[model samples]
Target: MQLLIMRHGEAGWHSLDQERMLTETGRHQVAECAAQIAASPWRPVQIWSSPYIRARQTAAIVSEILNCPVEEKIFITPEDDPGLCLDALLENQHSPLMLVSHMPLVGSLATLLVDGHRRGIPFMTAQAVVLDMPVVGPGCADLKTQFLP
Candidate 1:
């Protein structure tokens, strides 16, 4: 299964907890990333996004191009726990999955998947990481691939 992890585009910090929206640049970033995803050899079967407006908007753009439904997961909550999201990924073994989320979570998730521990990795706006999970020996796994926008 291929896991595509994406961080939402540039979101303006207008107010705390006010559900910040994406900037014009952010929208363009989304468009660019969406085009890349469409042109890439890999494709996701489904998209999972954070409930945050920025994340949802980015996912919506990609979903429009991919023609797939977006599945909102609470694990991508405002106060996110990367491990929980990883657990969610593990629980859903469906292949070619895409997750649209925030900075720390996206970076943390990638770091965890690759290094098996929390390592801070800054994600560019609209950037994504693609990881291939190899099923072997009753649940042991490792990071396979990582990509960016």
Candidate 2:
């Protein structure tokens, strides 16, 4: 199975984090990354996104481009635990899964899967990392490719 971890595009400031929406540049950035994925064999079969507005927006763009369905996951929020997110991801049998989330969660989840640690690696806005894992678990995945917008 392939796991694609992506950070949401740039978002404008809002009083509430949940209500923060993507900026015009953010949409274009997400579209660029989505197009890159569509051109590659790493196109996800399904996209799992955080319920956050920016993440959902990012997922929507990828969903349209890749023609894949999107599912909102609560565990994928910015401050949510990566371990719990991993468990939830395991519950689904979908291969080539794409996750659209926020900074800390996205970065931490990628490191957890690839290096077995929660130490986050920074991701630029709308950056994506692809991992190839036979079975989803800590330190079980190999870095495959990346997409940036």
Candidate 3:
């Protein structure tokens, strides 16, 4: 299975917190990122995102381009632990799964997947981290790819 972790594009602080909308730059970033993914060999079977407006909007663009359903979850939020979210995502991993989330959480998950520790980090906006899981076995998953937007 391939897990793709993505972070929402640049957002206005006030709008992100209040209006919950993406900035013009953010919209363009999402579009470009979606285009890149569409042109790539990596295609997601399922797309998951945070309920936050910026994340939802970004996921919508990717979903449209990838032709995949996007589900919203609170596990990707700032208030949630990224490890739990990672575990939830692993449990549901079916191959080529995409997760759109925030900065620190995304970074922490990537760090944990690649480094075996969170270490309090941050993933850049529109970054995608891919993990490979064994087709069958006890330790089924391992980090495979990490892409930056």
lDDT of each: 0.78, 0.93, 0.75
lDDT of 1 at 27: 86
**How many clashes show up per model?**
0, 0, 1
Q: Clashing residue pairs, candidate 2?
A: none
Report the C-alpha lDDT of model 3 over 1-149, residue by residue, as the tens digit. Answer: 67788888878777436247777888888788777777777789889889888889889988988899999887897556867876686578456888898877787776666566777456677767676755422244576666665
Task: Give one digit per residue, the lDDT tens place, for model 2 in 1-149.
Answer: 89899999999996499989999999999999999999999989999999999999999999999999999988899999999988886887988999999989988999999999999999999999999998889989899999989
Q: How high is the lDDT of residue 58 in model 2?
A: 94
Top-down TM-score ranking: 2, 1, 3
Our model 2 lands, by Cα RMSD against the true structure, at 0.8
- Count backbone overlaps in model 2: 0
Candidate 1 per-residue lDDT, tens place, 51-132, comes to 8888899899889988878999878854588878876776785678898998788877777776677665888988877776
Q: CA lDDT of 23 in candidate 1?
A: 89
Off by over 4 Å in 3: 16-19, 135-143
TM per candidate comes to 0.88, 0.97, 0.85
Compute the lDDT of residue 19 as modeled in candidate 1.
88
